[model samples]
Target: MTGARFWDMVCTALYLALYAALYAREIPVPAKRRSVTMSDVAAHAGVSIKTVSNVINNWPYVTEETRQKVVAAIEAVGYRPNHTARSLVTGKTKAVGVLVPDVSNPFFGTAIRACEEALVEDGYSLFLCNTNEDAERERYYLEQLLSRGVDGLILWGARLSCDELEGIVGADTALITVELGEEPRRSNHTCINVDNKGGACMATEHLLREGHRRIGHLAGPLDRITSRQRKQGYEQALVTAGLEPLPEMTVAGHPSVQGGFRAAERLMRTQKPDAIFCYNDLMALGALLAARYLGLRIPHDLALVGFDDIDVSSIVEPPLTTVRIPQAKLGRLTGKVVLERLRGSEGSERVILCPVELRVRGSSGNSFGEEQKKATLDALISSFSDGGERPA
Candidate 1:
């Protein structure tokens, strides 16, 4: 063979060798796995598939020995029940739906957790939906949840009227609505009521007892029932003290920090009240910032009070004095009510009311002296500088 022919053959051999090495280095793709089935478990347990089905569904007639055998076999075979198939046979999805105006809100978050805690014990899962306080969104969520065959629904601060709700909800799905205003004329569902009026009164009364005469109110959106009820309570407190509830002293805004800031600033700039009672904790936080911006001292120049003793309420600059809603208890109660409705234990639809308490803190002027306030503020500042740990 010529030198050129020998060189070409050598190069081809080298190329083939390199390609084989690369292919060997590559990881092989895994094949699709077959799921473990009830048949496999039944075969392993030496029992009929019908017996396995009876054990899974808790049919109450399976012998304990057979049940243990099937369970052990299921564990060994790694069998997972088909939820869709089981739901079809039982006609129950074993799920609950929860609709809230704002899921990000701390109050709702606490309530949701509490409700879920109560529900999960009974083998029920939760489907959470955020409506964002929109009527159309609320309707869409209701439709979707019902379509998924949720066993029950818990609605918090929904805007849908009773007629609208009745028209949409079927008889099979149990509903428990939170803070939906007055008792419904129709009685197809249960209502959970919180004492917004009484809670507001408590906040206002606390400020009054602290000797704040020219007290003002930073109200939430007037359209919301909670906001209106809170404002009414504030007015009632003022009237009970033989003081007129002036329109200028009561300002309405969105139930948000920005809304509170704008409304509080406007109210302070024009009316110049000594103290302010806020609609909720979020608005109260805004009012605090507004007070700082307007060169007002908290509790010294402009005392403040808020509703909804959220977690942050206790950790703010001087801490906030606000009305506490007992959200965990309320949530657990809500879950219980939903369960009762699901079981058809109640003869008629009814309303349940939850109570509230007032937590006094530094911002209310009666608690936490100047030195302790300074120490708390210092600790909070240090916590951020030292790895963002919360102060105990």
Candidate 2:
């Protein structure tokens, strides 16, 4: 260990010692008592300081009577263990930090919950921070978490700079980055990512299968690696079909419903592409809204396909066809990766691309006439409401 780290451990040990001493004080021999100590608690309880230590540490060796006395003395003196100092000594805080952008997104929320559940099994608490897609805030939170001695970090740093990532590597922390590509540094940073390009291509190809020649794209910010990859996938799908994608058909937006709405609206007014493949589900929803505002019927007028089959994707007015990513599974895998690293697995930096599948629904021209069948079923239910069980 470095000299600084060694001294830090020593200081923490001193604090624990002093803290125990402060609770052990006896009545008024001021000079003899160099401040309160665990000895004081022992004196008050008529037992050895070691007994008091056992009570404090919950060592299970102290008698019931001695435990009660230590407990009473502890309550009388308001003694509490300094967790920070203890963590410094043991090199562990039994906690992990997770940083994600926009915890409001259901995708992120599901991922976070899965991570928490996985970590809980190992007696690790989760400390979550929302970076709001800001690089500065991500760096600040990283520093704070490291300073507090978090055992590991699950970083979803789409906006972090290479320098910031390298610094993390330099610190030798166990970090697993989700939703971002490989760090452009010599850092031992592991990565877990969804197949954005593959999913996008799948969505685009679905639209192509429905004979959409002028398929537009509502894309996420290019600064995001996923966004750029998805955009490339869209272009690739069109080009492979012997159609050159028009540059003017793609509009960039934040990965949000509002961003999707605005970008889709702008594109509709200017280009009026026949179909749109959105970067994600929220943007697709926005595109749906924008299409409705333009007096267009989904699939019949303008088809749509989206990525990330969020829960609502199947519940919308026209159930959205989307690429289904295993978000919760991703979270569980990431947690396992972190736990393994923490347990002294110095494996090389690894990358995992979780698989995705396409679920075709009315939004992308329902694959097997399912929407029409559903429409028939809905009509039957409506007729029953009108007191006519049989269709006329």
Highest TM-score: which candidate?
A: 1
Candidate 1 lDDT tens digits, 1-392: 99999999999999999988988577889998999988999999999999999888777899999999999998999998887788898888889999999888888887788899889987789999999888999999999988988889899987888668867886667888898886754455888888999989888888899999999999987777888999999999999999999999999987778888999999999999999999999888999999999999998999888998776877887798888887767888889888887777767448888888787788879567777666655764775564333243
List the lowest-lDDT window of 10 residues for candidate 2.
383-392
Task: Give residue 358's lDDT in candidate 2 (0 to 100).
Answer: 87
Q: Would you estimate the TM-scores of all the predictions?
A: 0.83, 0.74
Provide the lowest-lDDT 10-residue window in model 1: 383-392
Model 2 TM-score, all chains together: 0.74
Stretches of candidate 2 off by over 4 Å are: 1-82, 183-187, 347-349, 366-392
lDDT per residue (tens digit) for residues 1-392 in model 2:
99999999999999998978886566465466344677777787788888887776567777898789888987776666555665777677878999998888888876777788889987688999998988888888888988877888888845876566667646467778877776434445678878888888898998998988889999998898888889999999999999998989999998899999999999989997889999999999999999898898898889989998776776687888888886667778888888887877766457777888887788878453766647645654574454332132
lDDT of 2 at 87: 71
For all candidates, the clash counts are 0, 7
**Residue 223, candidate 2: alpha-carbon lDDT:** 90
